[model samples]
Target: MDESFVDGVQGKPGSGLIGNRKFVISKKNLAAQNERGGEENIATGWHAIEFLLWGQDLSETGPGDRSFEDFVDGKAPNADRRRQYLTVVTELLVDDLAGLVKAWAPATKGNYRARFEQGGKESVRKILVGLGSLSRGELAGERLEVALNSQDQEDEHSCFSDNTHRDAVNNAKGIENVWLGRYVRADGSTLQGASLRELVAAKDAALAERGTRQIAASVAAAEAIQAPFDREIVGAKDAPGRQRIQKTIASLTQQSKDLVAAANAVGITKLTLVQP
Candidate 1:
């Protein structure tokens, strides 16, 4: 599914950007080929969907220049096939999310829910471990640091749509949700419960408040970067582009430290900020 096809089928209104058939590669098709003892490049997932929807970001001025006629009937070759592929991937994504929702439900018959329900202290530890690890390692290190260091557009989380800024902010929000013990669903409903913030507040109210403020600061810093992240990492260290990246990194690093302190305040004595 080419970016143009995605835009077209989604009713964005435009013609296909490039008429090449090579971009229609489907992961389901690739899996079938693999099962048949054949090798096919597997490049399908959220990023692939983004690529199909936004194509490649070939300019600093904007996102991929894909048009929308690729999925209109009789407008482009294999338009129907492109539509079918998009439908398949979209359905699969929804199904996967449903599975996660089921697993995380309070009454879920799974280890994930069971472990959290075992005890309040156990739950707190699990939550802080996840929060600390995500802030110090995955979100800060892998997502932000790796992309900034490499200065590669392909390394951008949503390079095609130039939406990595959203990724960073949302990631911070996720951390905040765990701390506050709340999550909003797609239908505008929220799941609320005891959270790390509540736990830490009981032990040390000031620390909990600090953690909350730090999380907000990090989110604000990330959202303040004016350019797409890929473009922000394109110059010398002291350049304005790199300066924006550094500011966000500094904010995340401080928040990570605050998260670690919050964990400690809640009695996680051996909690390590850096995880393998």
Candidate 2:
């Protein structure tokens, strides 16, 4: 018998039994035998196991020294075992594209789940052959959308509820955008750090002052209209005209109150109006 063949079965002394029943060596096997005890590193945790059985890893952990067994035994703390397992699982799934589709048809309910789903078994087989045992996250995301739609069928009523719509709107509104403009000096040069929060606050305060000035302008406009009518009615000394002035005063008061209410709704308070 060839020495290499004999040595392959009965590994060197401390390495453990080479040709024992527990140890099987064949030309087809690429991985080392565990019984021979040369590191026993077959990558056997969830990822390795998934790869061995399914021939793929679902998680995209990438090529590394860690094994599937390391994940199961908790020896590989740094490795992302979940990704590895998924990578292998996806790969294996791609192998029997037709079989997998038929098996998953009940869950998919005839709707296309992904690009692969559209192509059916042939597409899946091509993917498996091309990518081998790698799980593509982008493809997985697309696949998940199909799964989610199928799942939504089971809870149809809650799927399009008012609360869900409201939550989505509220979440969208939570995003805030703020712009910072450069502060310029008297000579037209920009100042460093001049657009900080304190400066912005001061600028906002100035805007509030301008808003109050608008209120003053509104009061002036109202008074201008009332003054001419008051003068006409006073000159005529008519009771009916005096009643009209009183109604006008009330209307102006209500308008002022409404303006205040509008300001409060937008979080704009503490206005200081300059008296004429």
Candidate 3:
């Protein structure tokens, strides 16, 4: 989900979705929404949970740090409501993830995974589409460039947690992982197998190698970005932090182009992103 947009009820009019800071912080608001079969606008997933825990990022140097007392009765306003809201939102998030798991379950008949497994060239096309879309439009453009151009601290992705640096690193690595068909398990083990990299190599070795190098460069560039991302986006246009972000953006843009070239080398004619 987009982090900046206001997801639910606005306290006042004329407040833009991305600029609205008046989130419904009252727990009672959750109850009312739940009874109404849930709110269509309540931002769900990562940012929603982060807001419930951290409140807001009022500072440029650090993330929101809501006190634990905020969740305790007699310590803060609407403590009970906050706890209930967290519980409900977390449960809903889990349920939604479960649905995704079912859709991609390897053995499920007529599920997305089943179709994907048999899709062959079309499936490869889908993978390329995903990598290019995420690298180019989603990360480099929408997420990074948008915030940098606006120079608004609140415009940074994961602003509430100041985790946008990590977001950039992990997202770039994720694209690399898909390309290499490699995963480093939590137990410090590595899984390597035949992948898009190998397939592309068989068709066009130089293109495959170029894609690998570009993806690795992007990951390295992303890792160089400093944390407290809100701080990073607010300085002079040529500031060190902003330059680091710009380099990552440039690398991801190049990586996305490499993905398209890789796709073409493998006989896929067109690559397209999922419609927003």
Candidate with the greatest TM-score versus the true structure? 3
Would you list the C-alpha lDDT of every candidate in the order shown?
Answer: 0.69, 0.31, 0.77
lDDT of 2: 0.31
Give the per-residue lDDT of model 3 (tens digit) for 206-234.
Answer: 99999999999999999999988877777
Model 3 RMSD vs true structure: 5.3
Clashing residue pairs in candidate 1 (N, C-alpha, C atoms within 3 angstroms):
1-24, 15-69, 16-69
lDDT of 1: 0.69
lDDT for each residue of candidate 2 in 68-150, tens digit (9 for 90 to 100): 55335354332233344344435543554766666566456554444445784354234222221111121112211222233
lDDT string for model 1 (143-234, tens) is 78877888887677677888887888888888888778899999999999877778788989999898898888877877776657787878
Off by over 4 Å in 1: 1-42, 72-80, 108-111, 182-192, 272-276
Per candidate, the number of residue pairs that clash is: 3, 22, 1
- TM-score against truth, every candidate: 0.76, 0.17, 0.85
On the 0 to 100 scale, the lDDT of residue 194 in model 2 is: 23
Our tally of clashes for model 2 stands at 22
Task: Name the best candidate (by lDDT).
Answer: 3
Error of 1 at 96 (Å): 0.5
Please give the range of 10 consecutive residues that has the lowest summed lDDT in model 2: 171-180
Question: In model 1, what lDDT does residue 163 have?
Answer: 84
